[model samples]
Target: MNTATPWITGVRQICLAVEDCDATIRRYYDQVGIGPWAVWTPKLTNTKIRGKTQPYSLRVAMAWTGDFMWEVVQPLEGPSIFREFLDEHGEGVHHVLVETGTEDFDQVLAEATARGLPPIMEGSWEETDFAYLQSEHALKTNIEVLRRSPIFKGRPEPDYYYPFPPPQDSPE
Candidate 1:
């Protein structure tokens, strides 16, 4: 019950900053039977690092096992919070994506800034906007909030499905 950020309704995803996303995905599947990961590299637009426009890339893999989503991100190019996290902490839990009940990312961003936990990295892909706030000092892990578009339902096809596609995606 963090009163500072009432916009956050619940935890939706837990993201791990990994050195190698595919290797980590393979290892997770081999060890814990977590597979069918959807992998993609998003073309982030209007990306900003500390209020300055700076571009970066990541190989991101996501998998859902019931209601919770797991995300692994490998920093691909340029400067990013993910890269900094790896340099400072190695591979580990970097951030948790929280569900913001509002569809307006600007409102969420404003609330976070007013709370003194400004975003270190923020960007948008298509109809979704995401912000990674600098909250490690207070919360131990960075906090990420996203405003997902209502028009978009179901997963946008990943670049590839790891280990193999799910039964629903399997070819006849």
Candidate 2:
């Protein structure tokens, strides 16, 4: 029973690495009504693979159900962990993201690495920073640390919105 501060905390987003993000979002919508999905092809900055900076791209869809978020990621360009997951596991739950606020991001990441769960991928979308940790062997899934910008709640003007976007006049 180790009470020492845990490496990861506050699981916020569950991400799936998929073959086709749009198709998955549509399936979830048609079958279960899990969406009104927001889709984006973000300009990722400072992307890294296992600590070495590199380039990669992804097609991402996000939908909020109740209090949690479901993210579907399709690797567009790779050498990324997402691509690795798909190659190995054939489209499945890839990671669970930790919602540590910006203030604690560095400290939390430092602690996680110190505890031997170092980041395999690191990148930024808009102002938000994120990292994927090597927690596969121990937790059976990768763990992500997310540092969100106060200005970004979610994509307001997404590249595409499935099941139709909300009316501009309506106050969602």
Candidate 3:
């Protein structure tokens, strides 16, 4: 495997955009036996789209199925890439997340941006920083770059059900 990109270690998660969060989660559990998922509304403090700040919320459910993590995203409110995917493609795999080291985070981000894949969504939670690159045209799916501080150990245990915010009108 080409390891020119030293920052990127491997695939961390695969994200899907779904219309109904509950139904999708239930279906995955029944059909694929993937969950007991942990559902939560990601609180993105400083999100950007096309390099401009945009407010958005996503109702996301995550589960670890063997080696990789799987994520289901339901666009809850505001202008988001998940909403755009749902609008354009209905429902399908939206992105693939890659793990990067915190030490090389800036270089990785700079390289992605220089290659014309600007971030559509980016935020930092505790010690982890994540950015979703808008590379669907070239790569067929968005690329999410994640870098977590060494202090950040792992995700919380899966939760059965987490209350999500009510849906809101899409941004104009």
Candidate 4:
């Protein structure tokens, strides 16, 4: 953790924005043996970007590479941070996520907000609440703060899926 921000535990995950998630996963598996990959389409509700509520969906795959997890995100539908990264920078590393206790999640957000780094995206995934700080200007990529609920124990083995569920109503 940086001395400036002690709330952050450490770099938990590194996310890449990919145009083809399957191909990327396959390449990583065959070339680097990064699998087995857990692939799913995340259903993010009550989403917000720059403080305005937005609804979005993303096809994501996760695989463990030693201590840190690697994530590949393919934006499926709706406006999303992944789509924005792809549009602006094509396919590449999008963000570095840091883990924090659920108890300190709000405080981390408050500290970031106080420093004029408002979240570019904020939403919940399963039992985790995540916020992506718009830190590209200073850090060359976004910074994601994650707070995992007890239900989200740790990474599981690869499980592939198509569309997770029917789309929800778009944000107003």
Best by TM-score: 1
lDDT of 2 by residue, 18-67 (tens): 99998899999999988788899999999999899899999989877766
lDDT value, candidate 4, whole model: 0.77
Candidate 1 local lDDT, 12-97, one digit each (tens): 88999999999999999989997778898988887999889999999999887777888999999999999999999999999999
Ranking by TM-score: 1, 2, 4, 3
Write model 4 residue lDDT over 37-94, tens digit each, in one string: 6797766766888899988888888766566788899998888889988898899999
Clashing pairs in 2: none
- The numbered model that scores best in lDDT is 1
**Where in model 3 is the C-alpha error above 4 Å?**
1-8, 101-103, 156-172
The window of 10 residues in a row where model 2 has the poorest summed lDDT is 1-10
Tens-place lDDT per residue, model 3, 76-158, is 88898888898999999999998765547777777777777778788766577889987999989999987778898654333
Each candidate structure's TM-score, on Cα atoms with residue i matched to residue i, is: 0.90, 0.88, 0.82, 0.82
Candidate 4, 35: how far from true, in Å? 1.2
By TM-score, the better pick of 1 and 3 is: 1
Quote the positional error of residue 75 for candidate 4 in Å. 0.5
lDDT of 3 at 165: 23
Write down the worst ten-residue block by lDDT for model 1: 1-10
Assess the local accuracy of residue 149 in candidate 3 as a C-alpha lDDT between 0 and 100. 81
